[model samples]
Target: MRLLHTMLRVGDLDRSIAFYTDILGMKLLRRQDYPEGRFTLAFVGYQPESEGAVLELTHNWDTASYELGNGYGHIALGVPDAYAACEAIRAAGGKVVREAGPMKHGTTVIAFVDDPDGYKIELIQRD
Candidate 1:
């Protein structure tokens, strides 16, 4: 079966939306608020959801923060130029935890950036 979407609990919906959309160059594919559940779900991605998988940012009305236990790893996004992507993200006020460079024990270029809630996102360079 194919993967659908990755759900992340964010503290500030607006801030997280900005980071994912503006900084990462993703589009807000779809969004809906679950009033009964006291939460909102916003899906973001590089293109329309009909094209491929996307990310779901879930904002619980009562949660101001999340632990993000050690078991969770970072989400990765493919880029045409890792170095240039990192530079653009930085210029847009995104936090680049790791500079773009060759990956450890490998030649693939990669970089890391942090979201509003401290979730790590990896940028991998692909032809």
Candidate 2:
């Protein structure tokens, strides 16, 4: 079976949407509000859900923040140029926590950016 979407609980839906769509160049695939649950789920991705895995951003009406415990790790994205990606993300007002460069003890180029909810996204140069 193929993998599906990754769910991230965001505090501010609008802010998270902007970061993923505006800064990261992803599209808002779909969204629906669960009035009874007091939550909303918005899907974002580089391609349609039928073609590739996407992200699910869940916003709980009453929750403003998450601890993001140490067990969690950053999500990774393949890029043609990690350095250029970092630059573009920064130019778009995204926070680049690590500059693009060769990874530690390895030669693969990589960079990191943080989302509105403090989630790390790793950009790995593939070609």
Which candidate number would show the highest lDDT if scored against the true structure?
2
Q: Name the 10 consecutive residues with the lowest summed lDDT in model 1.
A: 45-54
Please report the candidate that would top TM-score against the real structure.
2
Per residue, candidate 2 scores C-alpha lDDT tens digits across 14-41 of 9999999999999999999999999999
TM-score to true structure, per model: 0.96, 0.98
Query: How many clashes (backbone atoms < 3 Å, residues ≥3 apart in a chain or on different chains) does model 2 have?
Result: 0
Error of 1 at 88 (Å): 0.5
The digit string of per-residue lDDT tens for model 1 on 4-108 reads: 888999999999999999999899988999999999999999877777889999999999999999998999999999999998999999999999999899999
Residue-level error in angstroms, candidate 2, position 127: 0.8
